[model samples]
Target: MAPLASDPLGLAIDTTFDDTSVAILRGKREVLANLTLSQFKDHEEFGGVVPERASRKHLEAIQPLLAQALTRAGVGFGELDYVAVSTVPGLLGSILVGLTVAKSLAYLLARPLIGINHIEAHPYANVLAHGELPFPALHLVAAGGHTLLIHQTGHFQWSIVGRSVDDAAGECVDKVAKMFGHAMPGGPAVDRLALTHAPAAHRFPRPMLNDPGLDFSFSGLKTAVLYYRRDHGGDLEEGPVLSAFFDAVIEVLIVKTLRAARRFRPKAVTVSGGLAASQKLRAAFEAAAAEAGLRLLYPPPELCTDNAAMVACLAAHRYAAGRFDDLTLDGRPNLLD
Candidate 1:
């Protein structure tokens, strides 16, 4: 639907890593247009994103994507009420490209600028797609670079209760897939292979499952896969190996997340981020949340990955709160405590 003439429009830009994207939101609830330029093919030969290459690609794609998003939304630059951009916890060079472009647009248009936390924005993507989420929600942000279990008590208020101590879940998937000679951005490939293959008789260890706290560790599991390949003469069937690996990873994520859900008794359980698009992972979460009698929410598969829509969705709230940032804002590559 077209945005009403009176509806306020917000623009969002994100290039924290490989995905260069732009989006427009009408008020807080309606998405006018969301465009993303993926760099997966560029990084396929490298088996993962190359920071320098990613930044360069973002620089080239950001302006074009932004124009396309605005055109598709049927909104002009002067019509935008706010500009939001993801500015942290990502590749430094990549983050700077989007942040710089966003700052320039906000300045030229004299619009309010809002800086978004990439991780925080992921959960809000659900809010944008659906309506307001049930408060006190347990959110799992599982992506290539991060795996966090966050508890949201109110708008813009979050507490991270669990995090990956080593390789994030998505990273583990990629590494394992690379070991098996799978393509880059290997999570989806591994997931698909796992679905077709039966689990091997051997099982990988579930790290930190018995621990009494809410933290995650996948390095050991990744290593186990590596050693398994070596011991099996590096000729193990990909299907069974991937199936066992996928089961191990999914089990840990489900168990730890459910433990947190039960302990906190959140009204809803939300999962977002690129890996959240995994059909297998979503199924496991769906089953567990159902058993726990908690509502489960996730964005559409498109929103599950890195995109500007989540940034804009989050900006809508911050804008209403009168939160704005000045031109001095800079990219932060580390997570905020």
Candidate 2:
């Protein structure tokens, strides 16, 4: 099927976790308002997102964000070509806000409602921005709730080729950052500090890297960093020993992603989700892609984390392909395919 051209507009509503972002896309480009949570930035002080707190924040933000998106798009609710929302693999409470809101809008407007998977939304975000996604692609979704390796054979067609056994890459980063007294969304904090530490200063196990399967396990690496910090007090030459701990995590992440790229031999490989925002992960993936002669794609830094643009983008694709979900669709907190 042909992709959407520049003429038709696709409206997307994303309620993933605490942040609710809304946008209108003219083809692959965002042509409307985009809003994010200031609350999440505040919540980071506590080290992680609290479900109830996030749910409350979403309830407050969703209405305003949607109103602004409609205004910015210069269209009324009935004018939307398609209504899309992330329906699976996110906080159930948070997902409910978007689903109900989208359902109400779609029902009232008589437009099709598209349900999108939060993880699938991440990789499709790049496709929307780039105009095309090379087939048989590998997407490493390294985020808070999930660390999955996805195989995308076509639009809206994907399967989890592999995944983490324990502790997502983002979770590991957050917990490790907490060990060093860094801010929340520990991936970036760890990445920033890791720049000053030696990548080879200490060797942490790669955790299933040597295994023949494509699965990943970061729990061991998380514990390794914890023990390293506990034993050495996070001390390095000019900073806390936690600096070295960050370096180890980056190395393992890079190595594992690269190994996946080589083994899968996909047309393109995408590193997405919150950890995709990490400078360390981006640089490492770019280098690995170049060395292995594989295509690598990522969203803009802001789009890397949870946002409606990715959700909207995925929704657009599914909508265009005649994929729709009814009110029977419920939010899956731990929803898997």
Tens digit per residue, CA lDDT, model 1, 118-170: 88999988988788888899999997689999999988899899999999999
Candidate 2 overall lDDT versus native: 0.72
Q: Rate the local accuracy (lDDT) of all candidates.
A: 0.86, 0.72
lDDT of 1: 0.86
Off by over 4 Å in 2: 1-6, 39-55, 234-243
Which candidate number has the best TM-score? 1
TM-score for each candidate, following the candidate numbering: 0.91, 0.87
Candidate 2 lDDT by residue in tens digits, 164-185: 8887878887887776677786
Residue 185 miss distance in model 1 (angstroms): 0.9
RMSD of each: 4.8, 4.8
Q: Which candidate is the best by lDDT?
A: 1
Clashes (backbone N, CA, C under 3 Å), per candidate, total 0, 4
